[model samples]
Target: MNELERSVLAKIDQEQLARLCRQLIQAPSENPGGNEESTVLLLQSLLQDLGSTVHLQYAAPGRPNLIAHLGGGNAGGGLLFLGHSDVVPAGSGWDADPFTARREGNRLIGRGATDMKGGLSAVIAAMASVNQHAPHIPLTLICTVDEEANALGIEHYISTAEAAQYLACIVAEPTDLITIIGCRAAANLQVQISGASAHAGRPSDGASAIEAAAELVALIGENKQKLAAAPHPVLGPATWNVGTLKAGHGTSIVPDEAWLGIDRRLLPGEDPQQVLDALLAAARNRIEAAENLDALKLQIRGSVQMFMPGFLTDPEAPLVRQVCTTLQDLGAAGKHGIWTASCEGGFIAEHHNVPTVVLGPGEINTQAHQPNESVSVSDLHTAACAYALIALRQYETSQN
Candidate 1:
């Protein structure tokens, strides 16, 4: 490490930082309640210790977003490091306890290890480190909740008074140490199909909703194949999966209803409304062609559009330049690319005009929401060093 990098890393309290991360992982702030109060308080105290002003804003009752600011002077431009405190639910699989942070060999295992919390921890460490040097640029940390679900906390915060201040924001999402400049949008689609019901023995007596559902699923699959064959260049091609399907209630009766939940990831330039139009058209065609159907009906019941609005900062932008230089200066990973998966940065960028980038430590392929999810200790250390250097470089840029 160079003099600057070494100096920055030297200030990070590694043991204290790691302990905070573990304590948070043990809180089990999974969705439903998704209470981030405890974790937010822990971080709030750390920020206060660094001589920063802290504010805890609750979007809902228990869903709190923490903001802390540190400044040595007027600091011409502002920098916000964003992250979330809530984690996704830890379903069944696990060799070790999911909520209880377990350290073994060289990894820390937990639900949010790779998907987020580990990266969030690094930013906190970086904040503490920068505090020691008395940073010349004003720094703000926005740790929010509900990022794993609907990004309710961030959306609420941005729509309020807090978001108007920041000039630039970096979302600390797990990008495997790469600078994620952009991400494709994620959307939820619900397709409901209708048909008549009758006795199973008299097969010719009624229409089958299950049959229509099967046809719709097949049509969706065919559409996915077409999209794959002609993928988008920048954001990649639009892809989808039918995650949920439900049909009739009984084995002996002809099913009266069916529904499917489709998850679509839209590339940068794709039109979500057009995709819906096509899907409805395809479902109608397939259902009308059924052998003994009186009528085919379909409805686009619900959807959650992914909030990616296509943000790209020039490589020469002062912020981007500082980040690139920081990575190289610290001898950390030098790879840079936009992400294909969506993150909370999408919501923040669209709401507040701040140029947003997702950058952090954990690997993208770490099976984040699965059993025994873990983050490498070495990656965590490297991330702390990199983030600290980025903070320092941004301070230098603002001064110039």
Candidate 2:
């Protein structure tokens, strides 16, 4: 490694990264609770102490997106490092406290340990090192809220003038150091079925909303087959899963209402709105068709609760290339890959037209949101080093 690179890497303290991770993990920025206030304050304090120009853009009441500039003093533009502070609710089955971070050898265990608090802390710690070593390297940290529930944090950001300022964006989403250049979009599509109710004893007296919902499910199942038939080589196929179903009150009383929640995954280049429109049309058609509906007096409604479109960055982009090379330089995988970006990488790439990548410590599928979630300190420090080098590389490229 060169002198500058060596010096920067030397400053990436694993202990400090772990400490920050613990602080953030303990903050409990759960989305459903709208409790990101404490987490936002904690990050704001850290950034201010690091000499960053800090500001908070409220995405919701008491929920804010923290913007911190390490070197570039203005919010106009820089290499944007994006992350979300909120984590999924810590559900049951933890051996100990989900909020209490504990170390087991090199792994730091807690909620949000892998899904992304480690990724966030790693990037912030890298910025701290760069602020000390190479203050002229322009960096913008857009730490957002509500990445876990709906992506309102990033949604709010893309609506701002500052969103278009970034030359590139690096999403601090865990990829276990694999360079992610593309992602599959995810969305929540719900179907609400309403029908007249009557006594169950006289079955013909009332239309069954549950039966209409079943027809909707069958329609999506046919769609699922077609989607699975066509697949993106890198990011995989457009897909669907029936995750939730809420219906009925009593077996004796005919059900008046029913709800079905379907999860849709779209490939890059697919418009989320177009997909929604198609599904809505299909559902409406099925209801309108007397043959399919069997003359059931039912109203089936479809709505998109959330939609985060996928993105595919050019592998040749300078920042993207730098990210891959930096991972290799840090003695990790330089492999290019794709993500289902549960976070906002896709939002930034699609809406703001920013070249974006998700590269960070820990495994997304294996560790994120699981009981006893954890990430290795070794991985955190390595990721920090890579973050630092990538910042230096961005600065050097801008100079050239």
TM-score of each: 0.89, 0.95
Clashing pairs in 1: none
Give the Å shift of residue 3 in candidate 2.
1.1
Q: Any idea what lDDT model 1 has?
A: 0.74
**lDDT tens readout by residue for model 1, 169-200:** 78888887787777777776777776677899
User: What lDDT tens digits, residue by residue, belong to model 2 across residues 111-230?
Assistant: 999878898899889888887887777788888888887788888887883436567788888998898988888998887888878898986778778877877788889999898888
For model 2, state the Cα shift of residue 264 in Å.
1.3
RMSD of each: 2.8, 1.8
The total number of steric clashes, by the backbone 3 Å criterion, in model 1 comes to 0
RMSD in Å for model 1: 2.8
What TM-score does prediction 2 earn? 0.95
